[model samples]
Structures are given as C-alpha cells and as structure tokens.
Target: MEFIYTNPIGLTDLEVLEVGTQACTPTMKFGPGVRDMYILHYIHSGHGTYSAKGSSVSVVPGGLFLVVPDTVHSYWADPDEPWHYTWFGFVGTMAARLCKQAGFTGSPPVRNPDPSVPVDPLFSEVLSLREEPAKELLLTGLLYRILGTLTVPDDIPPLQPDVGLHVRRAVSFINARYADPIALADIAAHVGLDPKYVCRLFQQRLSMSPYRYLTDVRMRKACRLLRSQLPGIAEIARSVGYADPLLFSRMFKRTIGLSPSAYREKAKLENTPSGT
Candidate 1:
C-alpha cells in the first residue's frame, strides 16, 4: 500500500485532522483500529469492503465509507481488482452533523458523487496544501463546499397524504418567526405533525428541507438588512437567528454566493446616488 500524503494540522473550528490517498495491493487490508476524529474514504476506482462495529458495507467507484469518531473498524481491498482511494480525517463539533448531510452516518456513506464535481479535487487540494491563507477560514470554507456537494441516492419514501397542510403551517410559522431560534421539532409541534414527516413534506412540496427554507427567509432578511447597512454582520446574524458570527458568515456565503461584508458593500454601491 502507498499513501500519497500523510499529515496532521491544528485548527479549532472544522480542522482537517489528516488527508491522503492510497493504492492498495490485492492482499492489502486495513485494521480493526479506531480514530479520534471523523474520517471518510472516497473510492476513486475499484472496490472494497468496510466493516464497522456491527455493520459492513460494499463500496465501488464514487462510493464513500465513513468512520465515526472512535469506532473500531476494518477494511480490505478486493483481491481481484484492488482499490485506489482518497480519504481525509476531520474533527469539530459540526463534523458529525455536516457529514450526516451526505448520508455518511449510515451503514455505508454511499456518496454517488458526480465525476465532474470538485469534491475529489477538494480532497487532493487539502492533501497538497502545506499552508493556507488564514488556514482555519480557508479549510472551513472548503469543507463546507465539499459537504454541500455530497449527494446520496434518494431512497426516502414519497410524501404522505395531507402533508402539504402541515408544510404550509410550518412555513407560516417560520415566516412569523424566522429570527427566532426555531428547530424542526418546534415546527413539527407547531403544525401538530412529526418532524420527520414535516421534513418529507417540505422535500416533496418545496424541494427543500424546513431548515433550508428557514435559511432562505433569514438570508432574504439579511439582504434587506445589508441594504440598510444599519447593523454589523454579527448583529445581523443574531437578528436572523444565528448566534455564531463565523457560522453565520459561512451560511451566508453558501446560500448567497457572497460573504456578508461583500454583500453589504455591493448593496451600498447599488444603493448609492449617481453623483455620490
């Protein structure tokens, strides 16, 4: 087996614990060891088998396997075809949550990624980087993009009957209090429905999850606030139900394609008088 790169870094928020690529021989097998941080392997080619505590999964090209923090696991390459894969390890409070978006919390993180997408390249970039401009900021941004692009097969069942009414109720509640620290459970309770069912209704009726829709409302409000240029980004973030300024910035950039500061500047420029 060969590891293209192996290194660890230090960053508190969303740190890259390690990054590398490996080419395994027909007989290669990795151990029943565990890691301190979350790790995932994206199969670039060939196939392999991953075994966790009480579960195992088969993976192929474009597939991925996730190792949750401190989980004993083993993996081996297919004897006939072998396997070449790229992997990275990460750590942070948001690590598990972000990974869950890609369906990585399941038996197998079956990330059927688009070949043309930049997910693989992101891993390679992390592997290649010795240093970055504002390391924490840069790596965090990249991780967000990587997680954002992660797509799994939609195996969820279709929306249930009369779910639309609940969805509408949830929307109405969110519109009335988007700046509050509302949660899925709160919305479900408001609509007198289960949270998972509410999520399905949003998915089927609006093609977005309730949290996403809440974010949409918050971002729109942020735009209006940015145009007014009345409050600091931190204050604006708080006004929109976000407590962490950095997280607010990340979410703003992800949803709006521009940082809050940049968006505010742009808004200022547009709202300025012709002579001024």
Candidate 2:
C-alpha cells in the first residue's frame, strides 16, 4: 500500500497522526525508512502482520506495537482480511533516551496486548482525544501520561546519586529549552557526555528519553497557554515557540481536541466563580 507522511508542525516536540482504514487488501509495504524517533501503534481492531529486523509477528486487535528509531520494518494486512489501527509518531532526544531506559534498546518490535498492563486507560484517552477535539487540555495531558506508562518499566532498579544527578540535569535542560529548537547533541553537551552515551544514561535513569520528556513539557505549556485568557491564540502559539498560528491551531486540535481560542474560553468560564 502507498503511504504518505506529513510532519505536523507546532506539536511541541512530537508528531501524531490518526489513522483508520476499512481494510488492508493485497499487501502493503513500508519501505526502508529511519525515524530519528519512536513509533507507538495502538491496534484497535482487525489483524495484520509486521516484520522488522529479521523478526516478524502477527498482530491482532488490542495489540500495541512499539518501534524504536533506525529499525527496519514493514507491515501489511492479510489479502483477505485487512486491519484497522491508529499510530502516534514522535521524535525528540529525550523521548529516544527514554526508550533506552525502558529496556527498549534496538530491540525488535514488541507484540503483545497485555490487558493487565496499566496503559489501557491512557491509550483509550488518546483515541478519545482524536475523535473529540473539544478536549485538548485533557488530551495533551493523556499523551504525556501514555508516554510515561509505556516507557517506565516495573522491574528496573533505582539509580545511584551521581548517575541520578546527571539524569536530573539532563531533564532540567530539556524542560528549559524544549521550545527553543534545541538539539539532542546540545543537551548531551550540556550534560557533558556523548549524545549516544547520554541517551543510554537517560534511559537507565528515567525509563524514557530526555527528548520525549521535553516534548511533554512543551505540550503541557501549550495546553496551559491555550486555556489561558491572557493571550490570543496566535499570541499563545508564539509564546509556546510556534511560529505559525495555523500550524499551532492544527496541532492543538489534533493533540488536545479543541481550537485554542475555544479551549481558553471554556477554561476561563469554568474557572469563574459562581454568580460573579
């Protein structure tokens, strides 16, 4: 199947898309591509097959697939029976590093729909946000929660103080400059380590990368600004480090579920005192 990729600007540090299909007939191939990022695919229904790095697996409904960057992969639905799914694609130095911390190191895609896993609620919220644009703040909050759920492993040991110090410093840097077009290399340099090594260290400490964490910060800030009455949508966009108001609006709707202005008005009204 032919696929087109569009980078959605003004989405904090991440890019997300909502995908739905009636069927996957014949075979669809994902050509060789590398994402300097990570991909989270939540399978809501149907079935299909995915192949990555000499590993292949059949995907069923309710399955969630996590693919890390630079890994080769292809997927398709069975000729007779296609599949339906939604995917959120993201890239950031912090996010990449978080994947490593979660024990995801260049590993093959994980193919399990563990119902008992704690991520179901967060995933449900993300899907709900895609369908309802009036809930942007809620949606943005859920996205970060989802990332937190996915990357933080249950079995990892605590970090030593020195390592923890470096990790905390890295996180602080990411949070401080998430909206400033900072690069992963810059963050690594600030923390005094090689980029690749820093990524590993971040993954070890936080269970998610510094880039992903930074994206979360941006999204959170945007949501706050979008819901604030002090600034117009256009102004709010620029305040959050977005240059294009329209792009900011689209991403606001896509990720949060409402236009920035509408969200702001609603939030203001909700915050107003009764009979005031």
Candidate 3:
C-alpha cells in the first residue's frame, strides 16, 4: 500500500483545505471512522465494498464513492483481487459544497455510465501535480474538473426522473432553516445541488428564484407574526434571519408595500371589534 500526503497552506488552506491519495490492498480495511472533511475515491482497478449508513455497495473500475463530513464510514478491498483506488481528500467551504453539487451526499458509488471515460488519467493528473510549487492552486482546480465529469445537469430526464422530489427536498431544507441566517449555497448543499441549478429548478416549477421564494415565505410569516402583535420588529426580524431591524423593514416595504410597524398597526385596527 502507498499513501501520499500533502500539507495545506496558501491557496489550499483558504479554498481546498487538504488532500491526499492512497492505494490499498484487500487486507487494508479502515474503521467505522469519522471525517471532518470530504473524501472522494476513484477505483483504478479491482473491487471493493463500502459500508456506510447501514448499507454496503460493491465498487469496481470506473466507480467512485463520496464520503461526506461528520459521518462514520468503512470500506475494504476484495479478498482475492483486492482494490487499487485513489482518494482525494478535501475540506474548506468549497469542498463540501462542490461535492454536494455533484450529487454526492451520503449516496451510493458513482459509476461513470460511459466506460470510455478516462478515470485513470484524470486521477493521475491529480497525483502528478503533487510536487509542483503551485500544488494547492492546481489541485483545487483539478478536483473541480474531476467532479464535473461525475455530475449531470438537473434537467436530464433520465438522471432526474422526479424533479418534484428534488424540489421537495429544497422546500424541506428551506422550511427547516428559514429562521436562521442562511445562504443559497447552504440550501443547495442540503439538497445536493448547485445553487444556480436549484434556482433554475425553483423558477421552472414555482416561477420564482430561490431567493425570491425564501423572501416571499419570510414576508408572509412576518405578516402573520405582526398581526398577532406578539414579537417586536427587531425580535421578529431576528427570528426571520435578519440581524438588522432597519434592513428587515426595508425588505418588508419592498415585498408588502408597507413598513413592518405600519402593517402591524393596520392589521390591529382592522381586527378591532367593529363597534369599538
């Protein structure tokens, strides 16, 4: 077995985090260990079985497995032929986001539908850049290229037989996180999609971008909360993920055509007993 490790600094420290590759034997088995970063394995030859999330899958040539962070996973090479695979370990903000965008979130092995795809050469390129002075910069971009080959556009009917499934996942993620300060990237990661693609899916299905949908949802809830006269403007804004009440008021005006305070007053007056 051979392992190559590299220190993370410069471009890597900021964008990539850390990376390495390994070739192991059938006897080589790793724990039920947990990782704080993302790891992708591309099998060069032979076979292996990866067990995770209470399921096991066989992987062969032209196959890849994505191990997301904070999860316990284990794998072992085939007893007879063993397995030779390359692992590209990564972290940092872009690392997990890119992996999720490529449809790799606690799923099965990714098989290159087209066998002709040069899986070996691509991984070789990842190792070849190890000794260079610009290793981090080069490797960061190289990883992106490698992952690009594994992903398909969201619109492909064969790949996405049920667009509604993805849309529901997006909605679930939003409804779960709307109260917290969140970004489109985080939301996309939750659904294993690129933000742009998620936005496109939203626009096609709901006729609005993800941003607009989130804003609309927040404003509607805000209206109900204001009508209740329970939470103050600043408190309500914070509850909806805005740190600044002034900013939230501006957004409310833009969406509802009335300031938060004015909306609350009007709603309360309209609710008063008709004779009073």
Which ranges in model 2 have alpha carbons more than 4 Å from their true place?
A: 1-26, 91-107, 115-124, 130-137, 144-154, 161-276
| Number of residue pairs clashing in candidate 3, backbone atoms closer than 3 angstroms, sequence gap of 3 or more or interchain | 0
Candidate 1 lDDT by residue in tens digits, 1-276? 223222223233355644667788899887787654577787878888898877777888877788875468889999998889877666543465567666675654455556656576776665445455455456556667777778455555644557645765677788778888999999999988888988887776655688887887688668768877899999999999999989999998887778999999997886677797
Query: All candidates: CA RMSD in angstroms?
Result: 15.5, 11.4, 18.4
Comparison by lDDT, 1 against 2, better one: 1
For TM-score, candidate 1 versus 2, the one ahead is 2
Q: Per-candidate TM vs. native? A: 0.48, 0.50, 0.51
Question: On residues 67-98, what C-alpha lDDT tens digit does candidate 3 reach at each position?
Answer: 76556789888888777777776654235445
Per-residue C-alpha lDDT of model 2 across residues 38-150, encoded as one tens digit per residue? 67776666777777788778888877666665567777776666676666555543455455544354436564676655665565555444445444444435546666666
Q: Which ranking of candidates, highest TM-score first? A: 3, 2, 1
Backbone clash count for every predicted candidate, in the order shown: 0, 16, 0
Which portions of model 3 show Cα errors greater than 4 Å? 10-14, 155-276
Candidate achieving the largest TM-score? 3
Candidates ranked, most accurate by lDDT first: 1, 3, 2
Point out where model 1 deviates above 4 Å: 1-10, 113-118, 131-140, 151-276
lDDT of 1: 0.72
The whole-model lDDT of each prediction reads: 0.72, 0.61, 0.70
